[model samples]
Target: MLTVQEIRELIKVVDESAIDEFTYETSGETVTMKKSGSKAVAAVPDNGAHTDHPVDPVKNSQPNIQVEQTEVSSSDEKPIVETTADFDHEIVSPMVGTFYASPNPESDSYVTVGSKVEKDTVVCIVEAMKLFNEIEAETTGEITEILVEDGELVEYGQPLFRVKKK
Candidate 1:
């Protein structure tokens, strides 16, 4: 059996690490802790294996939305462009897996920056549980930016790309 001091030390070490989850088992002791990152406003008891401590549910709960608005005068010496952040974001890949841009190595990318995409456009493919899942762009617009890299592990509801509403 592991002593209380041993458990405390293990928890401290796991808490300091960047890994989201950790686990340990001894002859008569087992402990696990899962960290939820910096976006969770509150932590609830998740019915997974790790429940020894309350995990902070910050970064993985909801997307932190930000809107910025800028105004420009019409009658000015220079033609000014105003920026109004009134667009909606299309999040994709609601699973834990690797995201790929193309179907294979020798295929063209599904979408790119400045590419106009319609609803149901296959933006990317996510590989989960050894199965390929094609992720589509839920909204229609020009892909302004891709929020993730090719062959990257994506979290649930992670913003895959930014679309400027048309």
Candidate 2:
């Protein structure tokens, strides 16, 4: 079995490099890393099947991706013109783990919608293998959206919060 530190190092290397996919196998255990869209996924084998989990990987800044949706008018008129809008900066999970909105159940979440944050501010916690890791908002902004519920399982690179940059 690979140590947690080893896995973290691999994730860091893969995240920083331009390589799109990577895999490693040893002693019947296999780990695969792949980048898709803006998300990076790491998979490990369980009973001959691969299960994806989040791992500690640094986020790489990329240009905003725009998606368009078309809606028909209620009167059956022509479709409205497409409008372009920029997306907020996404705060992603650094590892696969259970998301906790607060330090404890009784505590308020680190941040909520409209909550302003600095680059070093901790926004949430992710628990993996009994280890609780604090996640930070690497960009200064106001929280615009929280993508996951407390106690939910989050995959590596999964967006946890969307921040409207200051």
RMSD of each: 16.2, 11.1
As for candidate 2, its clashing pairs are 54-96, 54-156
- Model 2 TM-score is 0.56
Candidate 1 colliding pairs: 39-58, 39-59, 40-57, 40-58, 40-59
Q: Give TM per candidate.
A: 0.50, 0.56
List model 2 lDDT by residue over 15-127, tens digit each: 67887878787876667766656544466432211123323433432322211111111111122222233446988876655778887777788899989999988898876
Task: Rate residue 85 of model 1 by lDDT.
Answer: 41
The weakest ten consecutive residues by lDDT in model 2 span 66-75
Backbone clashes for every candidate come to 5, 2
Question: Which candidate wins on lDDT?
Answer: 2
lDDT of 1 by residue, 1-166 (tens): 4432343344455556676656565553334445545321111111112111221111122233111111111111112223344446765545444667777766778899888888777788765434466776778888877777786655445567778877
Q: What is the lDDT of residue 131 in candidate 2?
A: 56
lDDT of each: 0.51, 0.63
In candidate 1, stretches whose alpha carbon ends up further than 4 angstroms from where it belongs are 1-87
